[model samples]
Target: MPSKSSARLAALTVAAVCSAASTVVIASPAHADAVRIHDIQGSTRISPYAGQQVTDVAGIVTGVRTYGSSRGFWIQDPSADADPATSEGIFVFTGSTPKVAVGDSVTVSGTVSEYVPGGTSSGNQALTEITRPTITVVSSGNAVPAATVIDARSVPNAYAPAGDPAAKGSINGLTLRPTKYALDYYESLEGMNVQVANTRVVGATDPYTELWVTVKPRENASRHGGAVYGSYASQNTGRLQIQSLGKASDFPDANVGDVLTGTTTGPLDYTQFGGYTLVARELGTLEQGGLERETTRKQRRGELAVATYNVENLDPADGTFDEHAAAIVHNLQSPDILSLEEIQDNNGTKNDGTVGADQTMSKLIDAIVAAGGPRYDWRSVDPVDGEDGGQPGGNIRNVFLFNPQRVSFTDRPGGDATTATGVTKVRGKAALTVSPGRIDPTNAAWEDSRKPLVGEFVFRGRTVFVIANHFASKGGDQSLHAQYQPPTRSSETQRHLQATAVNTFVKQILDTQKNADVVTLGDINDFEFSDTVEILEGDGALWSAIKSLPRSERYSYVYQGNSQTLDQILISPSIRRGCDFEYDSVHINAEFHDQISDHDPQVLRFHP
Candidate 1:
């Protein structure tokens, strides 16, 4: 008779198999000959013994995932082989509580399979698992294998292998080279018990009961303790994901820069959301770093404070108006001019013909006023229905809100959604033919993307051209956890073109007036060192103001384990020459899990 745990595991496995259309078909059971776990796991990403029947795979259960869709327990051979590239542990996908406790010496008969979590569409590497298992508990309370220590020195400095797509190439198909690349190092230890100690939190504690940490301080580590995000070139080599196997309440709410001290011991599991994760049974204590939320920036006389904020797809139906308004008023210090992105149409996500965001903007303005913010005037040119890429029918576009008492919109006539704004030389000064106009709305580069909204504002009797933009997002790009080394970035092609178009427009303004105060600001959706940003900063026509800050303080967003800048403010040579500008990236959002927007808003205060 099967043990109670084994029976429960079998019952759950059957139900899961019925629901999940598993790609690998189960094969007939092989003879009951003992097979080492390493032989089944192999030295590569794909198991050499995948889809083959294996019997009596002996090992001690190191960890068990009793809940979730991919329910399974990890088992590690007590005596690991000499090959460092081959993992000694493997996961048995029982799909339920496998009637095996940790430290039990078990031998099982099952079909080996390569299971891709979330299926093939996710583009993730297939995890080797033993399915349709028959378990035999040889003995109880066996000693588990010692955990492999994972720290900065243990992980390789390299990120990925060179790409070769013709043969399904590179890191995806090659044998594990644990000492050569970070991906390979993680792969070699898959399903093995591992330990991470004295690491800094890179990503905040997320809603999915997980956080990210780096074993060593990354390049340009923030004073507050977050790793500054640069380009894909700096592939955060020492970062790892942490998932608490205990109750959700037991998990700590840690922010970026906080430390995870002591030791977190767990089985390294490849997950669907993040790539390699330490599913920790025993998590270390979270040591707070005294990282407090930043307050609003201060405004000064003779200084025009301008800000750019991505509201994360705000609409009338959304309930975050109060929080967002408070952030703008109290945290941002009520700038003279504000550039807002992702403002949806009036009906919010409703797919009707309504492309106007008047209602949405009105609601936000009302909330701002209620929050003791100034009464502000707004301007924007709505995009064609369904043409702008975002939430379908949301018709998201950029808009400006200016305090009339401090700044006034320089309105000329004939500006509309389809009309491209033109630069004109007016009386020895650069001037827009129409203030608050769309720039090249019909450009192929801007197809299904937000067109730049250029507005000419008069602040303290001087003209400042502010272009609000929300560039093409980095969607459909290869994930860092992808099978390919240094994964292809197909999403950057359109952004490169978009950057060129905007740069050309800025050039036109500079050609007319060398001293023109042109400020381009919004979510560029790329890092400061990215090719897209380099195109915008071509020939020193414009300068990325964020670079003026210390390297440690340049980030406005955090993704995966990287603290990077996605929001930027680029100023013309005229503004750079004065050298009187002050910039602040208010850190109320990006570093915190309970954030209104995934991005932090940036403000530039300068005397014109």
Candidate 2:
């Protein structure tokens, strides 16, 4: 499954194919005492019956998950209690695949436990399950409960209730108001059979055969029909993730803006990657929207187009070179300058002390040339073996690809992996001590991350400084659905220091020559509105071009269900003040099912 942060679940599903007739549970004669699923679930986030033993918890099997480590079955009571806040169904955690079938009427005896996905440290909400169960087959071929329809009207507008101030904003103890909050609504139907009709796909299906759809069609809807996560306050409450109980090979290949036609029925379950998800027993039919890749217009005669693309750990071994080249030639229109991130070394992941990327860079350049783009020349300092924190042996680093026909690179000697690049004044103009160099490479901020690659390029006899960066990723951050309100972004601390260092370096260049043109662009691994971007734009010394685009068109990457911004190009005062710049978040890759990279390349065109 995709690892998450507002970023990215476990669990399987069942549908109409698994469910049979409406039935009620009869208390076992052995243990006359029985409990409704709702009574065990209670009205709070944590189950009221937690750690306590429940006898004769009876219901009909609605779904059976026969694969994965957490193999289990879902059972729902047809005769549900009137309380809307409590669930009518529950998951029976069987370590191995249970022999139970969909229509079997079963009575379970086990300890009620709150099982947290991804562990307690993940800050995820716990799932109420019946673990270490002793199950009795009362009868066979009974019908399950009718699925609760989850439509726009049924889900509330509010994302979640505020965590109690005393308990540090945790809503665990708060009573669920299903009609008022979306999280509460999902909580009420946890493990219950549910369905959505004609839902819009917001997140494209990933390798794990999982996708996301929104119950509310218009909630923060983007131009491309995906949900736009504009701010922390607007959580897009209607978004629900979908994963199949069926075979992965049988799942439909879907893209953004596509439709899940008719009804998709599944058991609602809380998961790790995604918060609340529909484990689909029966998936809806795919209705293609035919989303085509977007191609930006070529730059004007006087405009210099500089683009940034994360080739997604590209190596010579991957077959995506042709596709990446085509996107650069046709979709990006062959820019004058290109900043490439995640470019792996030669021999790709074979370790063996091979730090050179000549073969890898050569293949991409050759492919670009074959695709009708210019025969681009590349410049980069190979990282010190495994210091850069990408795939261990991949030695991923940033590289600058410039069209020699359009731009000239000022190649000064003495630049190496660990040597810090310095700025100097040559004849009253800002000049790099080394043309293609690493900026403050040994600094603590870049300890295990890709260092900033600063290079000097002359476009039309004007010196333009372009710094390519691939900052620390958001690996350890908590998800948006974390139990704690306003989940913490722990990964931003390193990016903060890195941003400060880069911002300070930009100031040094500007201090030497106030009118110097600088373009700072790459995979920021953060949102446009994040503290990292703000730090990079300190005191108007630099300004991000991404903010120039409208809110709906601002995103260059999609995580989970949110169309968010991660790649950005920030310009110095000289470039932003002229009002001659145009920025495009080229949507060639991110919104497609068959994408070459997870990030969509961003292009900036301006007169230097």
Candidate 3:
């Protein structure tokens, strides 16, 4: 099955293609004349002349996408029609290198067709294109068409169509309704020269040479900068993707909240990764955020500080080890106990049968000690060679790192990758049969996913039960920017089951010992508002500590302009009903472009 990102890209590709097809203007061969680019790209998404032959379609080549399967060039008419709904530009698909230059004025004759990316079964939109074209350069060095300004005011306040595609009219059947929906407004300007001025960075610069920006400040903007990714009801309408096609070096490294000044001019091109991207020729100046990385979290006496961090597939070969060590020591304040996720085997992405992360853990511990932190002791069950899923043979698993001077690991036997941990009553108190054990490792919910590692620790003579987890990722879910309102969360099913299993185990422990200091924390991979979190927090058995903070500060991760919580440290009710507990979502990463990990570590400091 395709991952959520892959599925979204497929869906967006289809939607863009289908939107282009809506502009076809059908005409008989006898009635065919020299067609302008705008006429070929009609007022609607699907072309009226789709699947028909056209002669002398004229425009100036503005941009060329030479890489990828969709190698093509974009053309825009200098003299455009006065219709706000009609685009003046169109993409010409040549399948290979095109015999055209950026400034060349060209005319071509070919059969108009609707091309669906990733095949028709993908249910994507069919892009209107002139395929197998015979081209003629009408002129050289003709001035390019002036770009139409598209500021926040020009974009609609709405995001998608009102109803289902069937109800709102099919992608190929609907008329252009640019005034009603942002999708329609973008569809109307598809393949057109456009410009956006004074934009604010909403997403950090990605590896794909793309970044998202908002032309206007969102109503629910984040106080720390960038737009707030709201619930299903609030779709960010002014956000747009900017892509550099001229010089890769010109693409700036920007974080969320950075500002781009001046005018960014380019032709708009719909893509699979992001919906509509401005293939920029002239870009704006990037003003740095001047955002400093966070310092060490404050530590207080008599409080046991426990933290959960997804190290993002950390291994010995990974170059971010030093930075990660610094973040843990300086930014996280060297918690007494740390639950680390995504600890790969000794050889990072090497798919060998090396399941032990001893070398990897040793290196990290060494780095931490060298970075002015205490020498830490670590313990984890080696996962079955190919059972736990992550990077192919990486054998990623959750491990515990503790300052031995401050805490002691209750080491016993019987813990392994495949065996489930058994609970026993010791002096009428809940206790793990094994010190470090896998919780229901063989359960189907954990198949092809990380199994939770439960460990017993003694901090200040008080035993604390810590279950480190890395739940099933949100791989198959629809993107927040999908055409569907309240997009489907297909990936939550497995996570829901996993959450239930963990919750049931926690309940068993609570049933035996009412005040068992339990901290189940790691990368849950679902938001605090999600059903997975709700399942884990069933009937008030567990409470997410992150919720104790202000709503504006609850996020541990940032994606596509939305500051959301994916990493959480949920405590049992016994731990929550105390007075000395304090939680913090330490801001060391996530929002910055130079992040060592995609997630920020969360810490819970309390007197247990």
Candidate 4:
């Protein structure tokens, strides 16, 4: 519970903090015409003056940042233009520390550029900036522009407008509608000095010295203070990323539901990871929420408990085994059968071609028993070296740990990484051809992704089938706040194929035994209402147990500020017909700042 997820947002404002200042003299080209700050930041997401040189761009230095590689200062034109759509501030990127100070009226002569954070393929909206600048101090000691207050009243409830068709639904070229769409509202104020006052922290502070808060505290708000992302329409426009212009060690360690009690002021900057980020020059006080991890109730005597948890690429190298063991034992109540995703190889990402996870598996088992939990036996198919894609060298795959005291594993041999397991009738009962076997591992649907691990277990003298999956990640998809409105989900194509493959295999089992108890669960990497889930539930083969929870409580993951469903448990007709199962998306890790994993484990209990 010491490390927080940089959440791939390590680039949020990597270089947004630093200090120093000076003056500059430049040999002005004839094309370097004096212009206003808004001229550089046009009415659209992209700048009109891109690739052109501009001179005498006058503004008061609102924030001087000399941190990281992209060091520079944010300048705001005190004399505002009449257009509300045009931003009056912009970032002047100086590869080195800036020779200027706050309130200095500096004119930077540089090529107007659009720097897409995380590069062009990252799906991040481009940041309009002035790079390779020549700075001229017009004057010093001038008052900085007053920061525009951003609260519930300021942000529009609507998320965004549709992207232009000509640009393939990219909203970048579309004119800003600041009053109507929240995305447009934030875009209109890009690089401008903005402030959120006394806001509630909806996201925990990460290792990157960043946190998230919602200006509109009541917008589909969870009881725990996190925002709910129910659909595309409910993007939670009030949520904004907060990063500070200070050292990482000095940054506040905040948990979900904590309050930042004061005016947190900064320039509105777009980032690679979390979209709109406010790089704070001055931070507010962090008031602890007294938030604590949740523990799911133990399974009833007549019921069996099953759970799925993504250990976030766990390996022997990580120090989180004890913490993870504690979660599986104390928080999850040591479910009878637990499926763990991202169990790395023995060497823990040391790519000498080792695929076996015996060391990694044994370490976790030892820790679990030490944590006052039942001694468990595990089953997993060793993935073909690096065919399962995760961290390059980490041969991560799914593993099932079941208590021998509670349930017996039906171990059918011949299950290897490359072989696909089939369902066969064993005395009129459904049985896996190879227990702890891979499902369609050779199928192209699992290419470069973790294949589904299916196993047969006996609980209370009844046979049960479990399929643990870690589907293809959403790595290549366009971000929610991308230039394209309704950003493209190119990564979902693989997930769809994966779902169909799993669905077909589940059908095979149900075909063999009509009353088979099957629990299909893991990190789906898709939402509850998504097409992938629909495919998984095709022809009523399976029903997502997450839907059983109210919309607000269905989430097992929190990204940005949205409590969402990325992990789920689905059941076959037999389990669904009874409708007597208990499911809990245990809230232990995702909500806290110091988390063992980015995903919360989901538990399901029912009589088999």
Candidate 5:
């Protein structure tokens, strides 16, 4: 075993190598206030002291990384004769001076602020602020500790249990938390850059393929970004597929020897085969950052037409969207706001290798533009598989497309859609809150996954709080006693919980806006007569615009050849009294006059 001093030296080296690109360095006690590079042979002699001032020290640069908004670099003392091993800090000021790259030995002086999160006893100190901690170059050298190359995505499943999910996979040193289903050791790297080495299994071969690769932080990345450098290993369930870095011509061509580096644009996400995270924006990549795009538009009447449609598993090859294209031009009733469901995210085009949902929405926008409709700004909250029962690379999700001129983008979880969370409900909705005239974005609701898509809409003279819901369906199980089985209350129970949550949320909103006009619409999956609807409406306390008409004529869906009213536009009396809106139960996506969806599309028009 290495001595404590040697271990300290090794740890410092690891930190330096890991953060090779950052500009700031870890601080040492020698020149406390001055931000200088120190080359300590061993790190054990370093004391657990911080917040001190150090000045004037020279050493070798080990690694670099970006800390929060600031860039940080690491340095170490070169003398093996030192009593205790120690490392010094080197801060980079991007505002005034140029950023320091790897292998540059610079002397600096500044305050030492130790990194202590919440409640931990670690004595390690983090280097911050290079402005006061002046740094000057002493020497420069080639980048040290060359990175090992590896392809992790190509590994096949070596230890997958029968009937296990298709996404489950393991690497030589990667292990996901069984119960929590997360990367337990990676909370800090949730929205940051990370690099790791793991075995890549190709065929049924032994030892598989081993390579070191950098993983960009994504919304669905592993918590400590998936552990590396350990006796513990990863198991490939074949869910993680990568090539020998040889198949570059046909694919996007990330070379096996290519170093992976990007920013932590999203959060930690997990899947069944292995942990999967997203890189919303890559520091250096062919793909642009998700936040880089701009939304264009045109504003019309005060009333923004809001439309929610479940495009029904949009496939690139279906070509049925041409009909949808026609609808945007002629058949479709233009709305100021449109929320679509089941939009698919394509990873290099698996569907007939055509355009993706991101581009499809763009095409839809173009179609609307050709029809002289307002240019719509759209956003999709990249959903990581495993959060509230999502699938990785499966790509299907709900999206919000709106008129940028009428309603400006406001506060979102990450400037995108928000997944609703609830204790009782399951299938979630994406919530968006926009203040009239592009007001500042603030957190509008305080619910977790499985909640409703709560939207604060400003229409006419009042800010209407609208909740667009696509509730749980009573399909799947057919057994009569399934509702009472285990903790799950069958499919009926699922719909019931959705109703309850919508009711609870609507009531809360109504409490503040006594005359609040709350309209709940979409494919509710239950009929107007179902008990779920009853609980949602609260014994005639709520009113369905369709209920005001005759009973037989209220059906909007055709079930088993019978016209069942599944799609409904329910509202609070305050909203119903304001304007006369008609429910256009047209066969929009319907085939040859046949209903397109198992449920029909309902529309509501009100004066703004």
Candidate 6:
């Protein structure tokens, strides 16, 4: 989440699928213990109970998301009556890995909590995360379907009873309304798969052009986790959800009734509806052949490297990345540590007039691979069903890519790209923790930036930290910086908070690790002379590539005829001794005003 400063600009995306039905009836039960999956639609209500010792559920896996290793998925609720998309629900685990597929029935056991609302936008309510009562699934399979749905009064601690008069207009089954204090919740369930039924499609609308599907729970819906793994709408006006969360461009010409199933790997949210909320995770369709081949591709050298790039809103206006793959790869060489900024995820158009982010990433990947780089493996940060943080994949964010030869990764915790963390930002950065031996030891202070990624790397005999940061632009609150304003809780002055966070973050890192070798690079959005840069440098002996060059030629990015050293490569002297890195200011847009990235390339040429 963008530190609190950028909350205002951060849009609200997901919401509770509520029905304008009757009030929910509250009741105290004999046992307020078992984690149950209940789906209440019209007069039908399905509830399933599970064992008290089970902690994770795995059935016909539905949504599968991966945050490094923390995974999440939806096991089919035997009590389901509607579509599996609506009936199967959510479960998360940092422990063992579960393998299943869509349409395949299974059961999982895990803790359950009620999902809180994130915010409201254009009449749609946003959810936080899937909330559930805890339980573990002992076993699962093509279980018998639910015969009937019990009243809300049948379940213990029913927030809204099945007959409560006040629970009529609920959001995602819960009576709660959307608010700003909501905490977006998500689970990490990668590699697992599942099958479901009773799904009905809701047509495209603002905030969501895909089909909004809802599934009824099975007869034993309450057996394990809650019902409703994920609810996805068709992406194309015709239907782009037939395949996994794979790229729309890579997908075959979508035919009606095509079964699209893939792995879930983003955030999922729950919204209040019928006294209960909806549970969901973002899913990516599994690739047919290329993905398997890429998965087995060898790495370049010894130590793994991670790189970040914006790819400059990578989307062809003429609709083709296949033709430009080679050229694009030449510009964005594969790196061990790949952090991509502004990558798209969904298949719909946003207010910004661009195709879906998912389409963009897919095309970029295909083009990159076709150009003959190490078959790089990639992953995206999915969104919570209820906490739909405005737009798909919780708003345009970065995805990480890695070469197995250099390094191997399991799971990485993902977050919204533009979450406003109170005093920090209006937009957030996607970050992850690395293994201890993966990097150098002197770079441990790299975890300070909320926008920063912390990962363990095994480099040369020791480990270190590597940070990728993109700071606030000269835009947003341009008037405030001119006025030299102080920080405030209001979203209006978020830029100040973003800047302050960077300043304090850098200081705290150095203060804590005096002998560390730190590297903070990316699109700072401001020139070397701006307050943003000075704030980042502080009283320390800060060093950047531009600092070593003549003032007139130090600029790395040129905007509107004005040259500015916005893209930088800053490092602590300790890590500079043996490193052979060069800041290649490609002047990307210098030749074409509309190049992919406004910023130039900053290359770090060190033997892995």
Residue-wise lDDT of candidate 2 within 281-375, one digit each (tens)?
99999999888899999998888999999998888999999999999999999999999999999987788888899999999999999999999
The lDDT per prediction is: 0.84, 0.87, 0.80, 0.87, 0.39, 0.35
Clashes of each: 4, 10, 28, 4, 86, 180
Which one wins by lDDT: 1 or 5? 1
- Per-candidate TM vs. native? 0.92, 0.94, 0.90, 0.95, 0.41, 0.38
* Over 4 Å off, model 3: 1-44, 48-51, 66-69, 78-83, 113-127, 162-174, 483-486
lDDT (C-alpha) at residue 283 in model 1: 94
lDDT (Cα, tens digit) per residue for candidate 1, span 213-323:
998785457867877766677778888999977888899998998899999998998865678999997899999887777875578989999999999888999999999
Candidate with the larger lDDT of 3 and 5: 3
The true-versus-predicted C-alpha distance at residue 437 of model 4, in Å, is: 0.8
Q: Show where candidate 5 strays beyond 4 Å.
A: 1-304, 315-318, 347-357, 386-395, 405-451, 477-489, 539-542, 549-552, 590-598
Using TM-score as the yardstick, the better of models 4 and 6 is: 4
Residues 130-224 of candidate 3 have per-residue lDDT tens digits of: 77688899888878888878877788887766435563324445666788878778878788888999888877886667788888776457666
Best by TM-score: 4
Q: List candidate 6 stretches off by more than 4 Å.
A: 1-308, 315-328, 351-362, 379-394, 408-454, 460-462, 476-496, 506-517, 550-553, 577-580, 606-608
Stretches > 4 Å off in candidate 1: 1-33, 118-123, 164-169
Q: By TM-score, how accurate is candidate 1?
A: 0.92
Residue 13 accuracy (lDDT) in model 2: 28
lDDT tens readout by residue for model 6, 293-371:
0111222455333344544434433243553344334544555656555444444324433323565666666666777
Tens-digit lDDT track of model 4 for 316-385: 8889999999999999999999999989998876889999899998999999999999999999999988
How far out, in Å, is residue 30 in model 1? Answer: 9.8
Ordered by TM-score, highest first, the candidates read: 4, 2, 1, 3, 5, 6
User: Which of the two, 4 or 5, has more lDDT?
Assistant: 4
